[model samples]
Target chain A: MSYRTIDRGAAATPEPVARKIRGLSDRAIAWIFVAPTIFLLLAINIFPLIWTIRLSFTNYKANRINREPEWIGLRNYERILTDSDIWLNMQATAHFLIWTIFFQVLIGFALAWLINKKFKGNDLWTTIIVLPMMLSPAVVGNFWKFLYQPQIGLFNYIIAFFTGKEPSSFEMLGQVNLAPWSIVIVDTWMWTPFVMLICLAGLRSIPDYIYEAAEVDRASKLRQFFTITVPMVLPFLMLAVLFRGIENFKMFDLVVQLTGGGPGSTTELTSINLKREAFEKWRTGYASAYAIILFVTVFGLASIYVKALNKVKER
Target chain B: MAYSKLATASAIAIAATGVAHSAQAEDLTLCWAAWDPANALVELSKEFEAQSGHTMNFEFVPWPNFADRMLNELNSGGQLCDLLIGDSQWIGGGAENGHYVKLNDFFDNEGISMDDFAPATVYAYSTWPKGTPNYYALPAMGDANGWFYRKDWFAREDIQAAYKEATGEDLREPQSQKELLQIAQFFQGREIDGKTVYGAAIFTERGSEGITMGVTSALYPWGFKYENEPGSYDMEGAVNSPEAVEALEFYKTFYETATPPGYTNSYMGESLDAFKSGQVAMAMNWFAFFPGLYADPATGGDKIDFFVNPPQNIAASTLGGQGISVVSYSDKQDAALEYIKWFAQPDVQAKWWALGGYSAHNSVLQDPGFVDSQPFAGDFLEAMDGVQDFWQEPAYAELLLAMQKRVHDFVVADQGTAQEALDKLIEDWNEVFEDEGKL
Candidate 1:
């Protein structure tokens, strides 16, 4: 089957072009094919990063082009590390990231397990469950804002109907104590399906013969689930957690549309704070340092987490 | 017969030349905030188009992200706008960064004097170093923060009796800041026509300039100042004065005790919606939206009325307006200048005010019927007379954001004492000024 295809490819390439290609060594040919990608990676990914690192040591303001930037050494980093507001933003980010992952992983695995079982209208339920994730985060944020409104929101109405309280008794997005959890609930609602799909893939990858062999061994249902199902899906669950964690770390648009990092900085995650510094405040050099610190933190965490995932896979 | 054919050819040549002259007209894009007044500007510009052969295009952005979008365009040296109706706070940056063309010569050549416009507008919207007239723009719109209320409810007998019984005073327009708060509290949770209505919808939004502008209405009246002395960045007692603390605490009390439940992150649009939908008894917004509000069939006419923001310690209001500047990067400088020169005329400004765009020209403001022109006209003039503005420094954004965070923290989040909030604000401002080498 391959001889005809190979002959047709040789005939399709012009004779002079094929000869030129055939003259080059394999390594050079490979480089010829990949040079554009390398150039693109350098131009987009590497060069800007290097430039940002340089700017981190200077006092360059993006809006003040008339003024010359001065070299300020590590002063920008020093100031960032010492700023209490920045630390508070970091804590807010941590709170969001950890809770969102915890909730997403918990509900996602449960949904995947239940959907894995044979049931009527399973595909329909699965599609319904995945609907929230299909919408834009901005759209989700805007609609959820209406839902969280106290006077007219459907969410407050649902709460009031259950608790026999007034619909205007509480504000989900307005109060300090509830605003953080409000974002958490929305994030969990939108992204749990993403984790569920991954978990579903994990659950489906387990062969039927394994369960049959466990049945032959007289293994109880509880023992087989604890031993086989949980352990096998552990790697997939960890992968989902890693993906959601990185994403929630950079959560900006949804939170912006919801609270705008407020009820006074209670929901001011680091990304939103960084945007204020960079764009709103135009503290370019300081923001550059902030960005580098965030980049390193994410890169380091992902590297360590990836290593752990690989180890789990090996096990 | 040959002579007649030649004469016909000459007539065709003349007609083609006229068409070519018409085709030479430049299309000028004027950028501004997307609001009711932007529509007025569009309608008014039709006159400019007929007068000058240049077509007008507008790129209107919503208020929340207007600064972010337009600043990015300017920072990138984009040619998207030939003229920009930028906020007054941007005059410093616009002049310093060369984003706006210096208009001193243009004004002189066109026989336009700075004295022809309102002094406050010229100082806020046209100058760079506070009062020095390094003109970068022409004052296009004049506005200030003011209040509007439900006039029909105030006249209700039962409501008036209830308010009098509750506060031992007749329900009328508030004369002081405390009276305003008292009135708002009286309206809070009051049942009207079998529907629960709240006090007011004031700005508490955190992302942009909403809360800062709203709070400044109180701050300015309480005699808040950016500096202890003019041209000095000394903000020690001036920013954290007892008066300012009182004003800030007053605003917080208003927010806490009066505003509708779940009205936390509201700005201008939300405030307008609250008043229009009969959810609030009083609401605060810029005077620019008054024309549209008065035109609202349900809420306007006899149902609503305007008031200048009541004074606390002194007479003051927050300024809300912009100057129209020719973008330096635009290639259509001549056409853009022509638009400005045409706009600065007394007749055109009169037309602008008639079409609902606020005109800062003295000729319009000093008209015999100016005060009696509309119901809000007197209040607008009063508000503009005592209007105060935030810092117009190039780093005004940073300063405004600092105040936004500190004030929002104390007022909306109930986090800190009023004194502490102002003290922390002083610290933030000091840091910014230090960064700018102005400390």
Candidate 2:
């Protein structure tokens, strides 16, 4: 009778057991497929992340490797959090983010909409407009620096032509107020096309039948655009925002080449400050802590943004 | 047939031994910044290799990432470089961190005393924080900061005559900050060399070392000190003194009126470019660039001239240069030390001067033969005499960054009054000192 009860229970639960056995094999296969990828991810990303976190708790100067690292828990974090300069750098980064996002989205959406309309040489115009995105940021920053030159630059020359007086003799990168905005302008020029490309894909993916049906319903072009075009492209727009946000958040090379966080700390982003702390100052522990803080901040923002993007997509 | 096979095997063994000997031949690797001085050092190294029977491998890195690259190499415990040429400011950290092999015994054995070098050059960049801290590096490039001008323009009889007529005083070399500013004002917006030239050019960029070096050269002589108090490592009152504020105000005036309007972003490279292009009548520069400016025809090689940094209440110039040191991690420490000994020989130093190396040996620099050989030797030695070495501390890089930021804010941002900027710098510098437990 006990044996019979056991058999009955086994039969009833066989679905989950069989499913679990099948799931185990499936998991094995899945792991087998992803083993190389996992190895790569660990090698390229997770290992470094763990090492950086470990270094954040120890005093590790790059120049002094042989010396035993001392555990200085929470000191680096304390320094960064309490430091006014770090906070100022954070403000600078925030300023860059707000201005860059506003300009990139507004300008990008408009360009995408205009290009979606079948105009003459639409393909050629679109290609030319998108070219800046393909160019390296360093290359673009360098050329724009040349353009802002007061004496021999084309930008000044054109300004001089319009005004009867010689162009306003302001040094764009030299002025503290202007330097941050200069970076914003250049970033916008280079990346608006990227946003536009995504929006364009979204626009093209919207079925033409929707527009046809709206026209049959006697909806005005403005009404149709608001009801269909915007709604359809919103998800793609969020995706573009997510990408550009992450990228611009970690900007280093271009700023280093262009203004070098200069004209004062006006253009010194958080990443640049962190670099100065770590490599230049050789305060490894402090820099690592700064990195962790930045990672957490960016990760949190990105997570929230990604969820929003998913919601938009679902709708 | 067995005897024949044995003979063949012996012959093959002998050939393999020969190959092994070849593989063991002496090879030395050297690394440095890929700047003009580094180029000169490379040229000198070829001569050394030819004479010493050692094959040399050269590694030249760009200036921007140079420190990080050298640090990585040193910390890796890899035999990347046998002989490393590095900035003098790195000496303290290098010594404290055991990145460089101590050279006191080596110097003594070689009979190459530090006293032979310009006293100012030897101490500023080559010495560690503690006076007796192992003496890790040999003073190699005893470079200093100084002023460069166009001799042709300065000696212009018509301009001098006009200035003399107006002021009833002979227009001559600048001897003080007051005179330098006056000279700048005299030449502001003047047409020269077929273009409108500015009076002066100096670096003012943020986060760069150039601005701090240039600005502090003026400020220090005017009673500004980066240390908090004499004989104290505390860095509070020194940076934001009344004298420093006055000096900065004077600097601002020159930048606003006499300098090229775009002076705020200028660095060594840009300042040199401006001078070479004849956009500026004078510039403050690293003395290392003197040879290159003299060699390059684009800058009127024969016409360019220089002066020791002028005094305000006292004479001063920013100390800048490189030191030659053996890698502490080297497997061939003895061989590296041997190289430094040979490098310090009087005859070798003379050759170094001939090949454009800034000889730290006073005997070579002050040699009548050397002076006669190079027309600019006198000025170079004069500038060397005036140089004050960088502030030596284990946390020097951080100290410099703090100063650079504040100096940038003062000159470029105009974010606060000069006093306010200097006060902030003092506070920041003190914070660093406090963190390091020196204050």
Candidate 3:
């Protein structure tokens, strides 16, 4: 049959079908297409989040399937809040987060500033500088472990070379005093490149005319840098800080690979402690509560940080 | 008529295929820690495969991640592992959580007697309530902490004379913990073969159970006990007795004075490396690794010798090894059980030993020439006789982690006194038991 004949015959038939087809709006059709994605998000992300929050209120163990979870009201949260070890973990995490970000921002901005100056083999130097961040954090953690070894590690030997101390005189990851700094050093080494790249972008985005205008106005090199360069780059620097802050707050794999959170809980971040509770100890409810606390802390801090960044940008 | 004939032929063909499939070999996945014995088990499992008409698939995770991976699989009800040779401490958790198939009825029906296994292995690996008849697993590998030393270094005439002159005693195998410490101290920074060598590399690993495993050898010999009574969570005095404090102090002293530089987190692998590299004169490690150590061309061949962990007030060694269990979540329990049955035979166990896997079977361990079979065989038997284990409660991980942190802080970090560390450990363990409603 001809296509026209088939279409005419179909049109002549079923008034109910034609009305049904015409009744659906463009917005309704769009909802039909987007429904699956929304359902998936609810299933995988939202559902688990709600379930975890619910579980935080109970005495539940994921491993003990034989026992039904008992609702213990705010017991888990109360215990966590009162727990000294959790506070110690928080202290360790804070030490790590503060020191790592400080070093990364300082060294990263310096490197970016230097590289932004047109220099010989600048592209090659940039690639080399970015290499550590490009590698797997697990791989970097493992190799850095070897490098931190006191007996044969190149790191100790290099330090010894300059300081006139014995190569095996100090233990990096072994001593309580050195372990936290050791993790900080490694994190700075690996992630500083990321901050450098962001700063480099920020540096490059400043229009040449701004610097030229400053030069014509007889502004000193340092004054121009502070007034024009840094102020303009503040938003991007804040963005870098925000990203690193969130990432380091939940840091697990690298620290785990490097030290497994310890010569003693000295380097145990909150994430590492939570993992020990949730998976190793099988304390599901306690871990969930701990996770929620961490979530709230991160969320509250980031919100404040973003608002501050927005204010700075408005200036 | 033709359609009917075709249908009949197809039905017969389908039945024939089903029968063929049933007769074909089944594939069984056995999960274990990736260690020397695991490799040995892989070689030994071939015999089972050939005899039982089943193909063996192995999932071997490294020691650090093994418990995490396997427990996750069990908790998630994943059927990834049909048979799991899990750590001894997992018996309580597995049994209570129904992760492992209860093997009592199966053992009775299959005529597989638990009595055939070594008593300590059965106690550590199979039972949950210490001495109960409840069976969840079959003891597969037997291990206990033992010492390996450089026999050649001790045999040197100059070193022997110097050691005797300095200590006023003959240089020999340590008969007591005091002597062990002296030997370790004597060898520390001692020049051997024109190279400076350090002392014994004991387990100081901070992460998992390394320090606890190492320190307990000293603890048990120095009169440390977990409780005043079995099944009681009462750890107040027993875990922190005066002798236990002394033991902890001694362990810390040894770690500081004897071990090589940066030996902060050394476990079996690190100890082996230190020994093989000639960086240390002696080391403490599990019996399971002894065979591999003895076979190493660089460090073996009259240069190395094995000894039991020395006595103090009492002689004891830390128990190490695992039991094999069928995962309850697995669909192929029958096949897995058949594999176990084949593995349980005396000959197979003997072959397992010959392939370097520690066979916990009494028949294998009790062989007339078993002690004479390998260089470390006698030491293994002696150590196994005095083996002590950590708590086997369902909350063992919590207890272990607390001990790890406490002991590590005191021993490695030098953060607190031994008494304080043990007291803190007691508090932590009591808290865990309270949470479990056992206190």
Candidate 4:
């Protein structure tokens, strides 16, 4: 077990094998473990991003392989920037993002606050409320479509019962004014639970001693809630908003199934429009440019939002 | 002993050849939209499988996603499909991009005459350069926009009396576009059998090609043409002409006044459901669904009747349905060709019609008993004769999407004048053409 004894035995060993063992440095060993993953990331993610950026500069029609891809530098970008339809799509996406985030935060916070109170079957009630978030969005979109049907949809029937309007009189996914809201309603229903769960975690994380200290000072319940609970939960709420804002910006499948970006493009989000351009129209080059613009917008906004979230966390 | 050994070797060689021939059998996959006709095709293809010694695998995507799925498959040169039943508008793209096998040699080798198939279908579904003989597909299914109405309700004595009193004509199938409007207006919100029903259900879907398909039924009869010259993309006057504007306006008026409340984005499925549920007096749909509608015990049988889409100034029906094409990327080309050859026979075409598919073969269509084969058969013949299709350019998706947005905006969203909508559509299409260097 002594070091000298071990060194004497090592001195008697063959040099080639010992040299081979010492040849690989710790840095070299680290690289051997990491190279495959780095190569894989480059192949799957970074390479595609670079390739997409290159394709964005060419006039490439995916379906027309017979034709050569012409170099049309800045033309695709120029056209997309000037396109009125694209601007309208941006407006639609912004509208959806703001409203969905607004509703999800407000309602989700309210639900989480209610569930945080000690009550009978609170765990069961919380699980039931989060079920919408658990279901597949595609399934929800399809069923929500039925629910918005003017003739037989229960959603319309419920609205009619409350408002004294005919069930078939209003078209939720059919009218110009109402179609946008229809998508909003469905998105809110499916995702509010996600926001609720995050808000609940924030609520539960607040220590009981903070409230106990406030109670000793004879502060009102409403004042204590505003002074302590609201501030404590603000960062988590901001984090939830940031997640929702990014997700709703790229909304496609649900809106596609629900309104299909219609009652005349009132709900055509950026993602749906991009898909139409790339796949349906086969304008791969133009779509790539459009996609890059979208990526930049989302990345820029998300970075700013995260900074704000971190600042709140520090506070 | 040498002669006997030679005989045994010859017998073994013949048996080996026979085994190799049997082993050549393939499992060919045919891709198409999931629809009533697709189900019927599954039944008809059994005969082809039995005859050709090839098993068939079907990939049927829903109509909404069929184009996206199949086009991606074709564009990626995927071998998922040996044969594709592509939409009529896809002929130009498929042919130009070499997604479809050039069938001129195959047709000649198989002795399959293009003349035997319906000329309109051959033009719409086979040829890439419009009317040229450059064949890429075989006309498999023929469809056109036609009207189905509640004949039982129209024949009610009291309702007939009321219609006569109001319009001084029998409440029958409409003969003119104006009369169709009048009839629709008469039936709008009308009570029948203690239930209130609306006038009609037409295409208003906006996500894909529904609005364009539905509106063109009205547009064609009003003399809406895509261009002044056949190949030229000069759509300034043709698409937004005064007549086309009038036709579009009439369609919007009909939609606004006659259609059931909350029928905003209805397509084939929605229209069928509306009719089957007895919510509408008239429904506009493709001829492919007539057999199924006629067989329905509740709303069909003796209760319903169909008519050719009524004319405005010219007689025309909007063409639908697809042609079967061998995928150029298929590994099983021989087996795919065999399926087409077997499917093109006169007897097989007749059986196709009998199995609820619209057979485009003239041998089946011109049969003496063909018109009497089904209730809507005669109207189908008339409609097919006058059928017109939308643009079949390589950039057809762009053109079609432009029309969908423009038409849906005007007709469904009530946003702009018909003239403005068509003018905007002309602008959108011209941009696409300019991008493709066609302008």
Candidate 5:
């Protein structure tokens, strides 16, 4: 059959199907189309969140499901807030998040700016630099652990060669002073590429004519960079920061594989502490309270950050 | 027509086999830590499978994750394991939580006496009230924290002369905790056969129970106690005793000045790796691993020697072992009980020891040639005689994590003084007991 004939046949639906839907309004049909999704959202996301909020007020242990949980009137929240060890975990988390975002943005922007210049093998260099981002964080954490090994690791050997110190004199993952930095280094190595790609997009998005226009006004190269290049890329840079900020706030797998929050709790992030409470210690109710607190902190901060990002975009 | 005839014939054959064995066969799964003994148990269960006409399966988790995995399984009432050989620390939780079948009635009916097992194993691995006759499991593997060393290095003449010159004493097996530290310090960063070797590999692992187990080896020898008196929960002076501080400081010294670089999170596997790879002069691990270590081609035979954790104020070894129990949730309880029955036989336990699984049976342990059976056998007996265990309370996970943090803070991370760390540990334990309503 001709294409037009088939089209006509499809367009004019059979009489019974058309009559079945004849009385329905567009909104009702739309609801029909979206109801399953709404049901799923309620079942999986909303219900669990509400349950967690309820559990946060109780003294429930997940492993002891047979025992009835007693209502403790926010005692879990009270204790978690007062716990000194928890404060230490928060400080460790803040240190990790701030340092990782700082290094990633700094190095990521530099690499993106360098690569933005049309040079030989530029695409190949971009691909090579982005290789670390492609790897699983767990895998990155695992291999970096070996690399940070003090005795026979390549990292120690490199430092020794330059500084003329013994290779085994310093331990990156074993020392309280160095362990936090060790995690920062691995995170920068693994995730800087992600930030770079975002920054690269920002760098590429700036029209070349703007640079040409600045040059027409006899602007210096440095002047063009400060006035045009930086201002134009600020929004994307902020977006990358927001993403890394929220992600690093809840960071677990990479740091866990690398440090398992040791050398004291020097590298124990808030998320690691949460997991220990919830799963290892089976303090489900307390961990629920802990999770809610972390959620509020991140959500409140990110909401403010997104508003700033939008304002930057408008500018 | 021919197909129908063949189907009928097959049905007749099935019925004939079903009639021959009235109790229909079932597949039974037994879960335990994945180690040398699990492999031995798998080999040993082949005989049980043949006799019982039941297919045997296993679920073996690594030691680091065994408690977390198996406890979750039992807590959730998962049918994964019909029988479980769980850690000694888990007995209270298992029994009190109703995850394990109460085996007292089964034992009574089957005529299996708990008296046939070593008293220490029976007390440590099977009881919830601890040292009581209330049984929840059969003591399967008896283990304790023990030490091994490079005998070949100790036998070196130049080393002996160097040791004599350094300390004005003979270099031999460590007689006490102080001497052990002295020898370990001597080996640290010393060149041996063109390779720079560390002093020793002890457990400094932060996650789970590594540091607690390792530090307790030192603590127990110094006469450390969890409470001022037994069952009192009064830990102000005892848990933070001067002896505990000294022991903690000694372990910290070992970690800081002696052990291999990047040995912060080392545990049983790492200890084994250090010994087998010839990286350390000495190492600490469980007696359960000794058979495999002895049979190892690379670092076994004349090259190795074993010692119980050396005494300081008193003789004590950290108990390490587990008992076998039928999970209450299992539908195949009869089959699992049959396996347990077969396992308790004297002959089977003797074969179990022969195959590298530590048999706690008196028949095997009291045998005249038991010491001569293996080089480390005498030390194993000595260690078991003095074995002490950490809290086997249902709140053990909480109790253990608290110690892991406090000890790791002092010893590995250098965060606080040993006295301060122990004080914090007592506070943490106090909070846990209060929550459990036992204080």
Candidate 6:
């Protein structure tokens, strides 16, 4: 049919379908709405990462404000890999992350389970338990250092009272043997409550009907818990693990306040080492490489953890 | 003709506005640490502004992160600061990176004399490579590391009698390493003023540069060398020689037996706390802190006295201080240089020292009344006279970190034997030098 004949089919021009079947233009308008968000994401996140990657291959001292920078091509990465101090800091960080996660999760989950039971003043107890995680890490680190004092501290007093011996003890921040564990204790004391809160939320979500069904089946309380409660709380526990893992991997502020990565490099975590290299040592190119390595490592671990979390959710 | 006249008048008005703007922009900014010294400098700088007719901008950073903050601002080539009072440790890196203007020609052109300032202070902090190029920085604060003790405790007849009975000699302030050890031993765990007090406490903090300051005073007098016979930067045996090892062992013994039980974590603040609390009979610290020590009524009431760090093989302490520098990136260089010159005058420097500051001017420090003005003035002057600095190489930061690591391991951690600590320190120092092509 001719184009004119299609238009002449009805009286008054059949009102020319004012609402066109607009498809591509509507999608184009939708993209226009999201363009700012895409630009923002690329500007804030992607740009810095690309810049850091570029700096990693150069010999740019971030502190050297005026010197013309030259490209060195992976020399900084080579140097970081070979540097014993960098490796030592990585080891310290690994030790801290693994141990702190273990203790925080174990203790937090236990506390959550205990508090989940119906008891008098359970709400008050839970509030009191989670209060430490609310305090600033700097405040916790400073006060804990004072509490860890060998002679004059209350911790020593407690030990002396129970053992009835003279209160001479190891220096917490000074001696290397005790310093790393000192950090561990402080970190656990602060963050274990966070894990506990997550576990509690998970525990509270368990329906009573599931327990009732298990009871009808004449199952033991332990058997019911193993079958119903644990599987239900598994996703929450993984979430708690993911958070604490990411947090402890970048631990800097508390260590800075408590020991300042000291009694001499004994507790210098990777972040602290990176900061020293970047700021104090003025080795910006090298520190950028160090940061990239840490970032990649954390990113890889988090991706794996997210996959595990997906599996838990599916189950 | 009427239109031409109007255009000329308008052009003349705009040119006048530009001239006025130029005059108003003649202002300078000064940055320094936030403390008594900075307050005194601010007071003195106002006089310069009054006389020179230039505005002043002062930025006083807290002592902890002052270096990092200033370096960031300087490197960005921003005019956030024009002049700075910087720690001596920052001179090498700051100068080499062109963050500061070389002041030799400026000093010459203005008839400004560096001789009026303390030679040691200028030699330690102002020159790059320890007196090579006049690259950047000027002498501002002339603080030096020194030892302080309770003169009353040292003068006690009972302590003297007890020490004489035990060692078969009269107890006097030690002048050599062996004697210093003996003196420290004599007062270990002594009951004084009806309270049990320790003999001495020198800071051994693993953080920052506290331990390095303590170890340097002991190392300087043991015939140690910071440079080789050919006059290159050599800190090998100097840091961990047999004599240095012996000195460290003695220090460890003093720490274990003579120091307060909680001294390993001691920093400047803790040392002050211990001294103020009367728990320590002796301490080694910065001379600038003498004002703070004397200002406190608890310890300032004629209870605390001081002496220079006792001589070992040579009488020296770490050349500790800061330098005033003009930012090369700043447009207000002329104004800043004028303010610095005004600050260096003897009369102004005397006021600076009198109003709770350490004078960097030689004339001001040497004035007869300087000793009588402040309680620790005599000791301060004596300590400043005996100042020696660390290697002022461009790689000084790396060198300091390397030294701190080894010294901390030996003294605080006891992770390795003294010999092993020294051997590793040598290797590390050589590694740094090799990387810089200094070896």
Candidate 3 — which residues are off by over 4 angstroms? Answer: A1-34, B1-24
Worst 10 residues of 3 chain B by lDDT: B17-26
For model 2, residues B149-172, the per-residue Cα lDDT tens digits are 877888899879866876676777
TM-score of predicted chain B, candidate 1: 0.96
Q: How far is B252's C-alpha from truth in model 3 (Å)?
A: 1.1
Which candidate should be chosen as best, given lDDT against the real structure? 1
Global Cα lDDT for candidate 4: 0.92
* lDDT of each residue in B1-439, candidate 3, tens digit only: 9999999999999999778756866899999999999998888888887676689999999877787898889889999999999999989989998899999999999999999999999999999777799999999999999999999989999999999999999999999998998999999988887888998999988777899999998999998999998777788899999999999999999999999998888787899999999999989999999889998999997999999999999989999998999999998999999888888899999999999989999988899999999999888888889899998887788889899999998998888799999999998998898889898
In the range A278-305, model 5's lDDT, one tens digit per residue, is 8888888989999999988998999999
Q: DockQ scores for all the models shown?
A: 0.81, 0.49, 0.59, 0.69, 0.71, 0.42
Q: Per-residue CA lDDT of candidate 6, range B1-439, in tens?
A: 9999999999998898777656754778888877767777677777777777678878888655665677678767778888888778778776777777889898888777888888888877688766674747778888877777777776778887888898998776677766766777777778888887877778687656677777777777665565555356566656667887876676666666667765776666777777888877787778878777777787775777767778877787777779889888888887788777777777888888877778788788777787888777887777777787766666666677777777787787777777787778788778667655567
Error of 5 at B56 (Å): 1.3
Cα displacement (angstroms), candidate 2, residue A27, comes to 3.9
lDDT of each: 0.94, 0.80, 0.92, 0.92, 0.92, 0.79
In angstroms and one decimal each, the interface RMSD of every candidate reads 0.8, 2.1, 1.1, 1.2, 1.0, 2.3
TM-score of each: 0.97, 0.89, 0.94, 0.95, 0.96, 0.89
What is the per-residue lDDT of model 4 for residues B218-283, given as tens digits with 9 covering 90 to 100?
Answer: 999999999988787778899899999999999999999999887777788999999999989999
Best by TM-score: 1
CA lDDT of A213 in candidate 1? Answer: 100
Sequence-dependent TM-score of model 4: 0.95
**Model 6 agreement with the true structure over A1-315: per-residue lDDT tens digits:** 686676665433434442342334878778889999999999999998999899988777665555567888988888888888778888899899999999998999899999999999999999999899999999998898788777677766777899886655557777788889989999999999999999999999999999999999999999987999889998999899899999898899999998888876889999888887777767777778988998999999899889989988997
The list of candidate 5 runs beyond 4 A from truth reads: A1-17, B1-23
- For candidate 3, the lDDT comes to 0.92
Q: What is candidate 5's CA lDDT for residue A76?
A: 92
User: Of the true contacts between chains A and B, what fraction does model 2 have?
Assistant: 0.69
Q: Model 1: runs farther than 4 Å from truth?
A: A1-19, B1-20
